[model samples]
Target chain A: MKAATPTGANIALFLAGLLFGLGLAVSGMINPAKVIGFLDLAGAWDPTLILVMGGGLALTLPAFHFILKRPAPLYGQKFHLPTLTQIDGKLIAGASLFGVGWGIAGFCPGPALAALVTLNSSVLLFVAAMLAGMALHRLLLE
Target chain B: MENFTPITGLIGGLLIGCAAVLTLWASGRIAGISGILSGLLFPHKTDTGWRALFIGGILIGAACFAWFNGGVTIEIQTSPGLTVIAGLLVGFGTRLGSGCTSGHGICGIGRLSRRSFTATATFMFVAIVTVYLTRHVLGGNL
Candidate 1:
């Protein structure tokens, strides 16, 4: 399969990022309080997050099924899908840790990055620490 | 719940799904925020350029939405210390886990991958429990 030109691929990547950030902002995911409200199942229990996930899955589920059937993507030479299939301790442990952090702060990586546009001090701090954490993981694990 | 916002959430989620589809089709990449950000931090020769452009697009996209929509609402309830701690956990955990919500939750589940299913279940369960502990048991406003 012939890959698309670099310029075409770069433009698509840029547009994808744009759409992702815009979507996060519009969905109110950028608001930590909204995320906390959804996570607070026993409390007020706002269900907006559920709809968000549902909506995302609605499109992605069918789209992925159809797209992967192709030998290659429209532009890319090959799909870079993950190869691992096992369920192991590392996955569970890491997910658990991430869950704790997400519940505590109501900030995941995507919304956290999108929220940076607001230039909020806490957002800045979290992103910095997040980068440091990534670095630490590489140093300690990889 | 009074805080429920179905329309915006669905629309936003669809946008996110579109972004994921576009990225995969054009560049054969998963639109996983953690992976993208980490790749930028630890740059590779051919990969760095696209990652940078994508992230820059995210920032600009958010800014554009804020500018056009009279500003998006954002509420960060976590204290600075807690935010930092949470950020660290998320960064480290996502890296160790090999994916986050976008990667595993949306894309992985869309592909019907067993590992993604397990990861999503684990994180969702743990996050629910965390909210219970922080909100009910500890009775903290975090």
Candidate 2:
């Protein structure tokens, strides 16, 4: 019930991100080949990624329920939840594009960020290009 | 499908869920990677600090894993040009769609958000078709 200070909140988020990255690495989710393997349903398909998703959901489901039942966060003032409930063109189109890109590169935001620690040129380039894309979207749409 | 480690995947996934839970419980924020990264690009005065910290923690955690757990492997078979293009598309699409796997798949799904469900289904279906077309129809070399 005690609200967190700004610094406390920041630290909490940092720890969360840290653990998330570590989990990504340990689970081999940072590996593009693994993701590709999962997507390769035609030949040598890997079902591990889906299992990972399953596991993540298994734990998140209960925890989220417990947290939401609380009046407020332990460190922050209020829950900043997503408000958009209606489906639309932008959501479908964007997700489709994202899925195609994910299929092509086998990288998403989380795994891509985790891969940055390797300092790989390809990873660096991907991150840079992704940031540019985000900027472009902001320029055109927002 | 060959290198599918269910236990490791589950453990790592649990860790990821724990991180998400902690972020929600402490900061009342959904640990959406694209959202976190996007907020960094389009900075608001109040939003800057935590986003940076969270990203920093991700990098630090990855570094720790690399140091302790041998290394993380990310095999990319696609050409460099294709990689950049994919990254761009991913960035643009995720932003336009408002979330990615972590947001829509994990957090949004956990929240039982109908829009997230639709988005997740769209992306999964498209990704499957894309992989099929690229690997089976297009000879698996892109």
Candidate 3:
């Protein structure tokens, strides 16, 4: 039988996700206009997102090292780290596709999910399409 | 656009980093939104519960932002059709790529993962190019 993940772990994950979404919202990342502004370098460039990305990196840099020093995670059996380290064609193609989408829509998975609270019609359409795409990937690729 | 707020951006990013660290410390999971959301759709026996809750938490957080943060302002300057296309591409690309901005850009780079660095560079480069083509060359308004 497969071991069940503890309920406490789920709760902790929920809380973490909540904080993450809240941070995205509070930082104006939920605004696609802001994202578009940042991408619009030739027009009126808004480099504030660089600061946001930088700030996230600054704190996480130290914290990750500290956490990795531990034997294992507090609640889980092991640190579920990514094993793939190669730079390949899939990575390049996928990144390019994602980048084009992001530039066109000004939303990624996190911010898009956070922006769902506003119930904008375009957001709804986009999310629906996104889910469909995921389903298609599952069907065709996996 | 005059809506850029760097201080809040930095603060929000730090909060996101904290959340990412907390998740890793507590669950040994990288706080990658695409991976988490995909897990829900794909369903792993040991992974389902936490995945559902994390996604739920994100929604709840969005609700809180809607309640206290003067509501989220979702401004998508593109047509519904274009938004849908972007969403589909994002979903497919992220899954194929195995990450996104948060996964590769933030957490992966923080760990000094070379794969993430390459992926990040690829995506950023493509996004910049796409934006330039759309905004400057094509005279498009997305």
In candidate 3 the C-alpha lDDT for residue B9 amounts to 91
- Identify the CAPRI category of the predicted complex in candidate 3: medium
The collision pairs in model 2 are A4-A75, A46-B1
Top of the candidates by lDDT: 1
- Kindly report which residue stretches of model 1 are placed more than 4 angstroms away from their true locations once superposed: A1-5
Clashing residue pairs in candidate 1 (N, C-alpha, C atoms within 3 angstroms): none
TM-scores, all candidates, are 0.96, 0.96, 0.96
Evaluate model 1: give its TM-score: 0.96
Overall lDDT per candidate, in order of appearance: 0.88, 0.87, 0.84
lDDT of 1 by residue, A1-142 (tens): 3333478789999999999899989999989889989999999988998888888889889988888888987775788888888999999998898899899989889999999999999999999988888899998999
Report RMSD (Å) for each prediction in the order shown.
Answer: 2.0, 2.3, 1.4
Off by more than 4 A, model 3: none
Tens digit per residue, CA lDDT, model 3, A45-110: 888788778988997788898899999988868888999988888888888888998888888889
DockQ of 1: 0.72
Measured by TM-score, how close is model 2 to the native structure? 0.96
lDDT per residue (tens digit) for residues B23-115 in model 1:
888877788888899988887677788888888888887888899999988898778999999999999999888888898888888889998
Report the candidate with higher DockQ, 2 versus 3: 3
